[model samples]
Target: MSVPISRLHVSHDAPLLRHVSEHASRTDWCYMHADVASAYHPCFSERLLQQMLQTQERIRRNLAADPDPKAGIHHLVLASDSDVFNLGGDLQLFSRLIRGGQRGRLLEYAQLCVEVAFNLHQLYDDRVHSIAVVEGDALGGGFEAALCCHTIIAEEGAGMGFPEVLFDLFPGMGAYTFLTRRVAPVVAERMMLDARVYPVEELLRMGVVDMVVPRGEGRQAARELIRRNQRIGNALRAMNTVRQACNPVTLDELLKVTNEWVDAAMRLNDRGLKTMERLVRAQQRRAQAAAPALTLV
Candidate 1:
């Protein structure tokens, strides 16, 4: 059985939850499900980013306090409570900030996002493994977030892409760096420039998604993977360490890219901003309809 972290009768106080719900698994892992309050947009709002940062910090503190690696969280799985994994950044906020010429606010938001992504990439510590369970669409920054995880287990029929190009912007968070690390640079560039949603099958073939299970089986797949990895925990950890060492994505790199993203965002003309607004409207319509459709280009 799983217990909500907040309700668990433990020695330590539970981490606060607003845009995310966290649970402790009986199988020796932590399960984090994203339940963004802004259903219409379902993006990573400022509050959500802050909450995630706090959650990660708590996890790190716990691991540090316990010298026994087995006593602490072995695997961290991230999934969404809604039909969509995540739609991406707060485009509505982005539009408002850009239109108002609030470049500083935009940079701040981008930096926060980078921090979250960087923390996930490092997995707090090498002993812990991070997995992203994408059971639905993950677009733009959302895709970047998933790519930061050590392993990506997606469900069939799920869609993912970098739709920022549709608004004449690229996914500046970590899409390019993460994708290039997994696949070829040309493939990453094409995916970004194409600006169209790709099916999970195509993503799996392209080496973007690590595993694809049947729809609605994402959690089970993740659990099974976690159990298997746990059996060879030491070996798995060492492999991940080698992987990270071989293809390092430093904090400096992510921050530099975020700076570029801020510059590009400020350069968006009225037409581009209007396109972004249209996408926001489309997201709202999808939310109201209660459909699992990806925003079209």
Candidate 2:
């Protein structure tokens, strides 16, 4: 049976949710990103990811049951939350979901997204390229989501990191696996442990972000990346493959380490802990400042 698209706890009081309901286009940026006004209406919504994953899973099962050397599409460019990319899983909403005996459903959604990430990783290993463009802050699960892409393009001052660590929680969406792969193990650890928000420039220098562009020009630069680097993506995929082949540790072995970290994170309690309060408040301030003003529908 095909997996069902899991429902999200979209707040009825949220202005953005209302915007989504009003503006015919909710989250699909397909033709618009390409600047084809004619193709605008068919924009890719977050629903697109769910649709793509379900289709891919079906095809994958068919292939595994048989064996097809040739299958799958070539390129896919997805737009994240307006400037923020994604705020990861809605922790506030998640708290309510978990309390409602819906943790399994949430877990299922997380697992599906994680599987999609694995597919992207394998695509990179098999010499296929995927690009993710970040226009603003990509926090917690959002950061992990971007890590799944082969090429990550961020805005000049964009913020990126696994801030979930600050919440006394571990990344349940495959952030550990991808972060270690993209940046040095030591550097990734430092970011995870400290739960600091680093600038895109720092991330780019550390190899966490592939490229940084000026504000309002990130999408343009990303398109140019596709134009200029014809074989660059393929080359990167091959390089990653070679490195994995040469590595002594297998993915299974790495997951064990990740589990240990998860266990430790679960034990943490940010309740009454002011450890990251300053940073958290700062982020909140920025979010409030940048948030588009609108009354709830």
Candidate 3:
């Protein structure tokens, strides 16, 4: 039986959750667009994280029940509805939690983030592949999220980097692990410490971004890649399996790093918190002004 894409129930109507929609032409492809309420500083809020967990669980159940990988979702693509893919962690929330000395809450948030990243890195199942379509700025945790995908297709002018170092912190959630797996550790360290956004082309040259498409064609490029993979999927999947077997990123590693992140976050001083607050204000201003371009901090 050919399972209809509409029957998968991946589409959601939640206001702050990702707006999922079935690809009209590709029955095996699922699209989840980040439709966050904080469009200016679109970070992974608690609500968004919970929704993502639910959606991934649903997909896992669906895939487990279906014997044929081709019948259901074989590809999951994460994109953004706004101009910026994501501005990274919720700085406003972080500042509040840090000031209140809420280490547990910080850990909880970091855990949720790592869990999502791990699931994406695992692709929910061995049969499915995950992709990220970056059309705009993907900074800090946003960049880390993109790195979790098996394939990252960025559009021209799209920016990616880790700006966490700006406020005396590092992108702790899977940034180091993912980047090391994709590139050299030295390169990854440089990127994290640089605190500057790199154009998609630069990342592509560094072999971080898998493909670069013309502006406004990221989705099309992903679709085309899927079409190509349909023919050699088995081989590609086997290769992915081999790659994982050779160099794996475990949930334990992510969790441990997240713990370290929480500890570091708790140690943020008055100066660091002030920097975070300034960034938060900038995000708010960008939101109010409805800026189309993101100048990554």
Candidate 4:
């Protein structure tokens, strides 16, 4: 059964989440739309993560094998529900991983998500337009995922931010690099460091989101953008030319920066882990206490 966005989890089975395992494997321009019906519950299930890794590997192989690369996919649009895009990783599971001394596994999980983010970025770099239709809250890894896309389209009521600092942690995914690329460094810094939540208008002002559509028309607006881009054949190739002409930092270098942050997160075991544990516990208590009042409807 499809769980409510507030109740969904990686551990909880939903056909859509299970379907993500097979999404990246399909070649020939995947016009993907992510409508995470249940937003707050982001489990990062073992099965789904494993499948995502496999699918990514398949994409890499396909990209490498293509003798003549061409622009594919009209565009990939990730759609969200009425209130939020994604609430991010399931903190309960994360706390379990941390408490169990499964740092290696946790890092591996984070790295897989990192790889996915980079792959998405490369797809955009190659001229395949990827759009994020954010209708609700997009926090932590969810925000990182949205940043990986080429364009972000949100509705008027949307909220986007990174609030992981409260848990004594940071977004181990590609939030740092992606945010810096999409918006000004100062704005990204404010978001990450201050854990500030930006409203739709504010995000638009900063140029983080390309367009703000009507409340329920985010998906339609995104597809329109994709269709417009599709009219230009070899879109990705043209974008690559511009990138080369501008002499921007290479993808390999960006990956290096992302990995350095991962390494730092991995090193947070001795004192850092203990500190994080306390912080997370306090947060969990507050969330648990407030759960009944935090209604989605």
Largest TM-score belongs to which candidate?
Answer: 3
- In candidate 4, stretches whose alpha carbon ends up further than 4 angstroms from where it belongs are 1-14, 18-40, 43-48, 51-73, 81-83, 124-127, 244-297
Local accuracy of candidate 2 as per-residue lDDT tens digits, 1-297: 122334444333312211111112111122111212121111122343355454445444543553434433234344543446665654443444444556455454554555555555553235345567788777776677678666788888789777666656666556767788777888777777677878999998888999888887876776676655554645654565675687422345434544454344334444612434444455456555544431110
Model 3 regions lying over 4 Å from their true place:
1-13, 19-40, 69-73, 291-297
**lDDT leaderboard ranking:** 3, 1, 4, 2
Taking the tens digit of each residue's C-alpha lDDT, what string does model 4 give over 1-297? 011111112343443232222233222232211223332233344444444444444555555565555535434455542245666665555667766767665655665566656665554345345567787777777788788777888888878887777655667577767787777778677788677778878888888778988888886786566556666647555775575467453445445655665566555555666655665565456445544444433
Which residue pairs does candidate 4 place in steric collision? 5-38, 5-39, 10-43, 83-136, 84-136, 84-137, 126-236, 127-236
Per-model TM-score versus the true fold: 0.86, 0.63, 0.88, 0.71
| lDDT (tens digit, per residue) of candidate 1 on 1-297 | 011122212222232233332334413233322333343456787766766776777776666676665543467777776678889999999999999999988998898888888877784556777889898899998899999988999999999999998889999999988999888898889998898899999988888899999998998898888768767887866876797788877878888999999999999999999999999999888876763332221
Q: Which of 2 and 4 is ahead in TM-score? A: 4
Any idea what lDDT model 1 has?
Answer: 0.77
Cα RMSD of predicted structure 3: 5.8
Residue pairs with clashing backbones, model 1: none
Model 4 residue 209 CA deviation in Å: 0.9
